[model samples]
Target: MKLTETTFQDGTPVDGYGPGFFRIGGQRYEGAVLVLPGQVAAWGGYEDTAPLIAAAGDVDVILVGTGAMMTHLPPAFRSALEQAGIGVEQMASEQACRTYNVLLGEGRRVALALLPA
Candidate 1:
């Protein structure tokens, strides 16, 4: 997918998914099919957000962006996700920030936290 627009999720015109990465409101992301949270994350966000994406379409994995500077995944929850055949990847908010766009570019299905900057 080639995301024609330079900036996504900033209220500017949203372009279809395409190649290259993107910066979402100053946070970098890949050009993958990412699920953006309307707001930041909390304990329930992970469970809440994942199913939303799953409902949207078929996905092999869901990248969970916890929040700024956080990178820990509850073991049981992680295992459950795995058992369901959906791999879960948790990155520091910053890494999530950067990788979201890149993974999108790679055509990966990702879910992002809409944390405030």
Candidate 2:
């Protein structure tokens, strides 16, 4: 097996994340955050679905980081996004970050909604 340097062609990659914050493109964001191709914004958890809804056309998948543990996303949230035609995958926050970066590096249309660990 061989390893290759990870790179984001046209998307922002998550550089690091901690208890309540995430670093991206040399900037750190606190609280739950939403990451798009080149944009990072605060996320309001399950209550705020508008951002994801609006992003449906731009992203094919959404990586949901459920804090420090892997848990199921609310059915309503999943339904809402599925209804809008966006695929949702839930995992631990840290795992989500790594997956998001890998997909982004491949130039796939993906986004991340992370709850800080």
Candidate 3:
């Protein structure tokens, strides 16, 4: 088997993540984070959908990392995003990170709202 490295020309890809933190661009972020094409910001969990909403026109989808487990987001939250005309996909945080990287590499207009595992 052979391995090929993943590159990020937009800004940075999530370098690593475990337990309660994620690493990107050599910086560590504790708790949740909102990752865009060329930016990453602290996310306030379910309560903080404003940032995502603000980027609705800029992104095609938002991948939500629901910590260590795959769970559903609140109905209101989901509805709000739907109302903004943005797509939402939820899964375990780790998977979300991987998916985000893959989508980003393809140059998709995607965002990641990740909760620490």
Winner of 1 and 3 under TM-score: 3
For lDDT, the strongest prediction is: 2
TM-score of decoy 1: 0.51
Per-residue CA lDDT of model 2 for 1-117, tens digit only, reads: 999897788778999999999998789999999998668899999988999989888999999999999999999999999999999999999999999988998989999999999
Checking candidate 3 for backbone clashes, the offending pairs are none
RMSD of 1: 8.8
| C-alpha RMSD of each candidate structure in angstroms | 8.8, 1.5, 1.4
Task: Give the Cα-based TM-score of candidate 3 against the true structure.
Answer: 0.92
Q: Encode model 1's per-residue lDDT on 4-76: one tens digit a residue.
A: 7443432221122223443444454453324443422232444544553443344565566555446687777
Point out where model 3 deviates above 4 Å.
1-3
lDDT of 3 by residue, 39-103 (tens): 88899889898989999888999999999999989999999999999999999999998998898
Please list the residue runs of candidate 2 whose C-alpha ends up more than 4 Å from where it truly belongs after superposition.
1-4
True lDDT of residue 61, candidate 1: 58
Give the alpha-carbon lDDT of every model: 0.49, 0.92, 0.88
